[model samples]
Target: MSSHPTSPRPVADLFAADGRLVAIPRRPARREALLAHLAETLFASGRVYREAEVNEALKTVHEDYPALRRYLVVGGFLARTKDGAAYHRQRTAPLPGGATPSVA
Candidate 1:
């Protein structure tokens, strides 16, 4: 993960006034937005990570690394091998109605 992410507009609203993560939203629309931003911060394109590596990276952001990792995969921002040993950033796929799932 890069130390900083280039500011995408939606990220402006996700951070608290003191520049800490307030919380990851629960609503699908808002959560997807936050997850997409998080995906960018945690994974680089063309990079593959072992499960431990992924968890360590996520731990830097939140205590609930497991949940964060799950959301990144389920939200379509990351992918894992069938064996579940490796993970990578994936291109965000469009939803059923042709809307891109990643908010950024």
Candidate 2:
């Protein structure tokens, strides 16, 4: 199966020059690409985060921390605890053609 979710936009288009999030794409593929980069770069795969920690890390990228956190979970780049207390990066599936998407 292809690693792309749906609408595979170029990964470089998702960010601004300042390393901040410019937009979260509407398409599933583009959104997943963004989330993957965020998850890989912002949070360590085996590390757990409290809600505040997650918010703080996300805030480093965008002002809308809560929305970004939610998108991370929803997009499967992050996984949260049953009580919503902690989060960690999920395993990243390899991309199609062996191309790993990045925000840059």
Candidate 3:
């Protein structure tokens, strides 16, 4: 008998046929996973991005760039300047429910 641990849903499954995110998950765990995936794929480490650059990058994945941007910042996936003019991907980010993601 073999038992396997439950695996997280594939990040790709969250996207629609058009290659855009269908919807942002409401559940913290699921949402956090999605956000982390986005952060990894969308932005490069150690590179500062202008707000418009971030928006343009996010718009490729979802029509609701504003909400996605807010989530990324609020979820700690992306750090922003005080003026909200600059953004960059963080190496480690806090998940929802106050849990930090494990660094690999």
Candidate 4:
């Protein structure tokens, strides 16, 4: 699980009055968005990601990348060791129906 809950938007001020959540914002990232980021990061981080390396790489994006890591593992976007000492991006399979998405 992620140590920090993800917010789609930045939380400017928690409480301008009494430290209560007022005018709450919603910026929830879609599962795919997170997966994409992970994919890119994994690609750039060399083949295998050590636990600390993965954490440091993703710390800025999310409080902790574990939640995203778990999501990716479950979603088939990434593969991990049972102990999670390493991580890798799964070769992207074509989207269902196999018709190739248009880039234009």
Candidate 5:
């Protein structure tokens, strides 16, 4: 049996009609893809965001901003300061096994 979701769907299908995410994927590959997309669309590179700013930006997509924030940080999609006061999108995030995605 495959570890992936029963049917692999496009990253876009995870969002609801109102544009908020319906659910966060449990599969590593899917979750990684979602995180990458969120980081790219919601954050600007080289721009530092306060914790409140991160929450607000995430809230635009889902009510559970904390969960999203945690996932982004844990997945290496967003890097935060030692104090967790600021965050910035990472250029290349590491995959589930600590492997960084290769740039084209």
Candidate 6:
């Protein structure tokens, strides 16, 4: 899927500089890349992330605002909540008999 959502521009096509990819100083597909990127960062913690905090952390890598928002919401890398956002960190397992899976 393209990062633009409305268009066909893939995030990989967005570049850092000529002949080299910076992965920061971002453009259209910036958010699309965030989930996987942050996962690599927060892997050891196994914790949830609020949207704003996530953006702040990502800033060290990319410098765009709108693209970051879109990536978090549209990319399904994180889930938004009334309090803020949580990184998608857990796997769902089937419940026994008729029970529903645990929710946080």
Over 4 Å off, model 5:
1-8, 93-104
lDDT on C-alpha atoms for all candidate structures: 0.78, 0.79, 0.87, 0.55, 0.87, 0.50
Global Cα lDDT for candidate 6: 0.50
Clashing pairs in 1: none
lDDT of 6 by residue, 1-104 (tens): 65546664554554455522355434444533545555455432346666667667656555764465556556554455555545443322344686632227
lDDT of 4 by residue, 5-91 (tens): 655533324224543334322334444554655576544522666667766665545554667556666776666777777776665
User: Which stretches of candidate 6 lie above 4 Å from their native place?
Assistant: 1-35, 42-45, 83-103
Runs in model 3 deviating more than 4 A are 1-6, 93-104
Q: Quote the positional error of residue 41 for candidate 2 in Å.
A: 0.6
Residue 21 shift from truth in candidate 5, angstroms = 0.4
Task: Give per-residue CA lDDT, model 1, range 1-104, as digits (tens).
Answer: 77665554475576777655667777787788888888888789778889999999887766788998999988878888888888888877545777532222
- Please give each candidate's TM-score: 0.71, 0.74, 0.80, 0.51, 0.80, 0.43
The order by descending TM-score is 5, 3, 2, 1, 4, 6
Candidate 6 residue pairs in backbone clash: 31-71
Q: Which candidate model has the greater TM-score, 1 or 3?
A: 3
What's the distance in Å from true for residue 79, model 2? 1.2
Candidate 2 Cα errors over 4 Å, as ranges: 1-9, 94-104
